[model samples]
Target: MPATPNSFSVLSHPSLDQSGGGTLSSPVTRPVPLVESTDLLRGSKTVGIMHNGSLYRLQATKLGKLILTK
Candidate 1:
């Protein structure tokens, strides 16, 4: 089914305070592809819409940035 017009709002994160005691239990947003997986090539910057039609601005992560991938 198609989404109702303008029914979504951009996700938000609150500023963290000392000791990181601000909404730490909340889930972090993961960057998602807009059109297709091909739109975001591994190791390249990508600006596209998610499957849900939400706009996302993303860049591929560097090799050193990842600790593990499973």
Candidate 2:
């Protein structure tokens, strides 16, 4: 099973730094795209998701939790 963001947003968790004044209603600013569930896979902890003008690797744990691994 894959983890579904409880907040319907790929960038809503508190772990994300939301100092850009983006809200649940308006979650994107300056082209920050959302990460999808299909991007996550078992045994594959690294994912390429762009944010803050850089490519980030998002990791998924055995518990189906998505996290920024890099």
Candidate 3:
């Protein structure tokens, strides 16, 4: 049997400066599936994120969109 791949990787290219200059920085790379927002949403209409001791709500709309509110 073929061995299953254990992990995934993603390659990101550096952005170039618009002032006729070369690349602004070196490329950045990371593992695949960096963030799965859906997983965090977890079939819920809202999720809470706390920042500076304040709670923020992220809501999923009927139009299949997201809205963040403090």
Q: What range of 10 consecutive residues in model 2 has the weakest lDDT sum?
A: 6-15
Off by over 4 Å in 2: 1-19, 22-35, 40-43
The CA lDDT at 31 in model 2 is 32
Candidate 1 per-residue C-alpha lDDT over 1-70 given as tens digits, one digit per residue, 9 for 90 to 100: 5644433232335543223776545544543223433344454545443656655555445542322121
Instruction: Give each model a TM-score.
Output: 0.22, 0.37, 0.49
- What TM-score does structure 1 among the candidates reach? 0.22
TM-score head-to-head 1 vs 2, winner: 2
Cα lDDT tens digits, model 2, 1-70, are: 5655543324444435466534355444443456456555545666687778888787777897877744
- Per-candidate local distance difference test: 0.42, 0.58, 0.66
Q: Report lDDT (Cα) of residue 53, candidate 2.
A: 82
Per lDDT, the best of the predicted structures is 3
Model 2 residue 66 distance off true place after TM-score fit, in angstroms: 0.7
* Inter-residue clash pairs, candidate 2: none
The residue-by-residue lDDT of candidate 3 on 20-64, one tens digit each, is 445645443534344455876998889999989999998889998
Q: Between which residue pairs do clashes occur in model 3?
A: none
Worst 10 residues of 3 by lDDT: 10-19
User: Candidates sorted by lDDT, descending order?
Assistant: 3, 2, 1
The per-prediction CA RMSD against the true structure, in angstroms, equals 12.1, 7.6, 7.0
Q: In model 1, state the lDDT of residue 21.
A: 70
